[model samples]
Target: MDSAVSDAAVGVPPLAEPDEAPQPWQTDRTRAPVATKIVVAGGFGVGKTTLVTAVSEITPLQTEALMTEASEGTDDLTDTPDKTTTTVAMDYGRITLDDDLVLYVFGTPGQQRFWFMWDDLVRGAIGAVVLADTRRLKDCFPALDYFESCGLPYIVAVNHFEGSEQFDPEDVREALSIPAHIPVMIMDARRRISAIETLLALVAHALEETPEE
Candidate 1:
């Protein structure tokens, strides 16, 4: 028998193995999508979790604690009376857009006590979304002031709740004292499409503010 044939018949290993087909989940390094970090910030009960939940393709990581008597006065439940939980830490999720861009969304804890985490959360973030509830406009001031003081590019996304009075984007901008250049959008955090649009706007704004390489 020929040496090569004999070796093959004896189960000798080949010098090189053929490349296997790429798996469905495998992504090409050269063509890999650009991934960016985005912080979703807002006051308590403003639907930060809902927005992240709606936009994320995968199940989001939530750090919620059941509302107890301990927070009765500190955390107001006026508008959201039926609410029974609060984000004690943070909410995290991811979404991909245009098939070439990926966004890692991080939702900050709305309580003042957990605000110490904001510094770490926004460290490498490209921008932020400040969700606002019209009924309690003051609730969002802390988040707005935070991002503003940090000089991070951000947008005002009013999470319009049903039965609440609707305001035009411009009206919201004026009410929030947002700069004219900063985008203010009326979005429904519960709707995936609306949340996606708000994220798209933030991405566009961040790109515009970013210096060209």
Candidate 2:
């Protein structure tokens, strides 16, 4: 579905027209930067690391270790034969959206064994980006359910991998049984601009879900 139509269906406020003057809060420079926490979660080898690295301004901290015989039977390498490393803990990065706003991104380990660390990683997160792989769409379900149970708003971003069959956002949404209000979009995790756009969408969705003071 088109973004405009999706936004309307999901109750996301439309972006202000370009000619409109900036809001007082937008123009304010005296306020201290607000730090927001965001989670980048998905299944194994679904590009969570790439997304975090692409958008972060600071050096990202990654805990990936080389794959070994220990995971021969447990880890699925059929879809990702070239994947030699696995995240043992989490990946962290930071992005400054503007002078007044910053985002702390935490990428969760894809393996179920490391999922125990997610509660701590997402302790104060405002929202999440659940990266989806068309080839392994079911892998994202756990993350999606976790965020929902925690009352954390999130947007699903389908990562486009070379040679993977392209699926429409609506089809993905239906296949995943995603609600109408949740956004589903396509993205290239390796590209900085693409990752930024996905992050912006999550931020926007989080803002909309936030109750006004």
Candidate 3:
């Protein structure tokens, strides 16, 4: 007996054909948005999370852990004494620019022990924004070196904290020995407009450095 006939004879219904109909959730568009990945890196307590939160269109994903006595000497809180939580993993957020470009931002964990995660986080990233604090300028060196050694395009974003002495971008460049070609900007991480500008700067720099395929 034919399988279809046998099944019908057995009172079994034939299997339904796969759905060719468009899903209600699906939308048709002439062009898809361009998506890019970006990394926000800096030293411990340098406002990486704040920057991400400020610019993220959706609620940002955070992996912060409360500071404990165990981290006493290892974690320095001198400049950010009020900080009680530290990002143990990475911070994630998304933003859309120009209606056709989407940016997926990832903020690296600032603790030295979490440096291992940096390699994984930077995968597929177009470029990076290395956040710096004048109070602990040396802390950002690791991030800067990591990006440079890996040959990734990066720009420095000095996160100006309130009450901290502000320095000119050129002065910061000179102080950090950053190459003249690398753009550096002073921004407040807590402000949405400032963070957005920093992201725009990074996107522009990355585009300039990337070769057309």
Q: How many backbone clashes does every candidate have?
A: 0, 0, 0
Please write out the lDDT profile of model 3 over residues 38-74, one tens digit for every residue.
9999999999999998777667899989999999999
lDDT of 2 by residue, 1-213 (tens): 575675456443344444756444457777656889999999999999988887776678999899999999999988889999999999998766655577889999999999999999999988999999999999999999899899999999999999999999999999999999999999999866678789889999999999999
lDDT of each: 0.86, 0.87, 0.87
Model 2 scores worst on lDDT over the 10 consecutive residues at 9-18
Q: Which should have the higher TM-score, number 2 or number 3?
A: 3
Please list the residue runs of candidate 2 whose C-alpha ends up more than 4 Å from where it truly belongs after superposition: 1-31
TM-score of 3: 0.86
By lDDT, the better pick of 1 and 2 is 2
Question: Once superposed on the true structure, which residue ranges of model 3 sit more than 4 Å away at CA?
Answer: 1-26
Model 2 earns a TM-score of 0.85
Report the lDDT tens digits of candidate 1 across residue range 109-180. 999999999999898999999999999999999999998898899999999999899999998888889999
- Candidate 3 RMSD computed on C-alpha atoms after optimal superposition onto the true structure: 15.9
Off by over 4 Å in 1: 1-31
